[model samples]
Target: MRKLTWGVWLGTSMLLAACGGSGGSQDSGLEPPPQDPRFVADNAQWREERRERLLQPDGWASLVGLHRLELNAHYVGSGATNGIRLAKGPEKLGLLQQSGGRVWLVPERGVALTLDGEPVKARFELKPDTDQSPSIVGFDEGNGQLSLLQRSGGKALRVKHADAETRTQFGTLEYWPADAGWRIDASFVPHATPRTLEIMDITSQLQALPNPGVVEFERDGARYRLEALEGEEGGLFLVFADRTSGHESYGPGRYLYTDAPDRSGAVVVDFNRAYNPPCAFTDYATCPLPPHENRMDLAVTAGEKRYRRPTP
Candidate 1:
């Protein structure tokens, strides 16, 4: 009887212990959030966007021309020779026109202009700006003159190639799997005073931009916030750095956006979509840096991985 009682007690104790362990595991912070269905569809869309942008319009494939006139420039269009040669005077003003079905730049006579391997001599007709202007402009439409006006009052299209050191040498970017665990349905955390955010440049210069409210969420029982900035696209632009940066991800930081989300304060921050800044590929862009407030103390392991490339 004594032996049987001892065995029963031992069995009961083990059963109770197992139940307690199971409860603790259910609430462990080690596991990621549940997967959301919408992210699967979003992933497909991003892949297509990447192909159209990075693959087809290889930056190295285009010719960059910087036309700076001392007073006026003589040139050729596509169809005439000893063409509309005019001096650097008032006569140069009305030579070219963009009207009807086409635009024309009647070049002065005896001038030569070869375009994309075609021996284009001076002519009375004009041709199109052959390159697709893919880079989003810093100015508004009809304001393309901004690009025409070069940096530091000079005129030049700083050249970058498709086979650029960054592009050519890039290995596959690392990413946290598209598991729904990272997407936390979040809500707006409004601020009374609009905050000013600064993005640090390569030269360690800071540029200030305004930010409205922020989006907030709770992770590991701690509340975190990301302030919002105005962007051309209708979404939030978040520049943030964390402990994982430089080690598991881009050294400077990773970026995220506030796309449309559901009710759970759950926003899909697809790490796979994280990519290099324009600075990575070329020197001409003015990309915004992460704000100081966005810097997180913890490691954000989910999302796009660091870009691996050969030394430039």
Candidate 2:
């Protein structure tokens, strides 16, 4: 059977000072050569962009609920009596029906709602994320969104609201200092034939993702290899865990992305860019776990650390 290529759907700074007074034992004036300015600036920019993406109205942090759509129909809303209870929304938002391998939404009369940004008076089919253009049901005056998501286990509804406590109370994202040394040059080793890697997600759903090759690099005189997944845009997607996992980093693992190998099969694997998955921020996400092959015994002290949710 042909293996499936799952698409990866997702989305940092400081300053320093110099010394003066070249007398009294002649201060070296070389304050540890302040990490490559370019590298530091780039890393800072990346971190800031990452934070902005997460704080967006529809970002992972805004996710408030993930309800499985197993039944034929379900009334969804914030009301306690609704079949699918939402954390935030109008009392009678809409009714969803599943048929013909598709989910349809019927807006509740007298309730304001929009289907794909347009007013809807009749039931309409909801496009799942599998489609090129998925349908979005907007509610709460556009602050809330409802979308269909299909995962390894089954189909479900992913609800996001700008006012979600998770998003409103999001905490800080810590990281180890950005060091260029973490960016290592690696060589790609292609498989004789394509292979499938069994990736188990946070939901414990095992999926056979396309595993096309491996990247090998040497760190501390030891050769380290990571199996590479064929990303949606032809880049290399690496989900990995290291010695820092559960101690200094996210327990499950972190994600990293790299451009395609060059003509000489050379790729740059920058551990400094490794980041935590969405599951680290919210429980609604079904993030894939790192395969055993990608687990490194080496401690990767770079990239993001385990998220610390702020206290009320």
Candidate 3:
């Protein structure tokens, strides 16, 4: 994504001022109440932390390649002649062999290599991210990282480089002004039995992830429901699309994380903390699209706006 320039920032500020505040359209009838000082400060801090994470050395922005392990055994490197050529790495990195449902890597003799941060003088087994401790091959003096990512289809090599253009020239992240009105209190309705949702990712792979429940909330006097997926640390993960999608937000959708529902079935769904998916930052990412049921009829002019990649 392109960094916001001074001119763009000035224009956005002017636009927000003209809109009589942020978070929604001037005529949406969902105008927020007086802004809370603490809410604004906390939201600002969250956005800052989000930005810093994306700018990290091996963050989403640093993703440079996703190559499938096609043949059973193949030479892998940045060289054009290699069977599995990488987008960025040493010319003759190593040879990867797959057999009996397992993969291993044999580093080239002279290349400086490390397997999980230790010197790699011999071939070692490569584990997929699904494992408790996935294997990582580091090269380029620690600037480049290689790992196996298990996708719906099969395992693929995910490459990230600290010097990737996406990271080195990261653009500014923009969001609607934080509003208390967007911080909605809702109810979590659990399923009678455990269920799964077939979510299609950017790569067109269908993933049957766990569907724990549904989050039902009221906005502008209209009730809406979003399917909730099992999230990290027992939280709730939501992928949703609103009226602003394609026009004012990422066309596919945005992601939100909320704490698990309390014993009383109450939950807080803070739209202000919604964020773009990894695909927004790098092409190498495979981000899930919002399920049809989660598409909202209302325009949520809060959270993130559509990202405009920088002009070459």
Best by TM-score: 3
**Cα TM-score per model:** 0.53, 0.88, 0.89
lDDT of each: 0.45, 0.82, 0.84
Candidate 2 per-residue lDDT over residues 145-228, each given as its tens digit: 999998778999999999999999999999888888889999988889989899999788998989989999998888888899
Roughly what TM-score does model 3 have, to 2 decimal places?
Answer: 0.89
Show how many residue pairs clash in every candidate, following the order shown: 16, 3, 2
For model 3, how many clashes?
2
What are the RMSDs of all candidates, in order?
17.6, 9.8, 7.9
Error of 1 at 279 (Å): 3.2
- Winning candidate number (lDDT): 3
Mind giving the per-residue lDDT tens digits that candidate 1 earns over 1-312?
011122233223223332322111112256555556687678756755653464333342111223332233333222333133221112222234344534344434443333333334443333333325312211111111112222223222222233334444444544565665565666764468877666665434566666756777666777777776764454566776655555555555666766754444445444455555544333344445555566666567666655544454
Tell me the spans in candidate 2 whose CA falls farther than 4 Å from its real position. Answer: 1-33
Please write out the lDDT profile of model 3 over residues 1-312, one tens digit for every residue. Answer: 121122233234324433434434333566467798999999999999998899899899999998888889889899999998888889999899998878999999899999999988799999999899999899999999999988779888899999999999888788887988889999999999999999999788999999999999998788899999988787899998776665567666799999978998899999999999988778889899888778777778778775666656
Q: Candidate 3: global Cα-lDDT?
A: 0.84
lDDT score for residue 309 of model 1 = 41
* Candidate 1 weakest lDDT stretch, 10 residues: 137-146
Q: Kindly report which residue stretches of model 1 are placed more than 4 angstroms away from their true locations once superposed.
A: 1-41, 56-157, 162-165, 168-170, 193-195, 260-273, 281-285
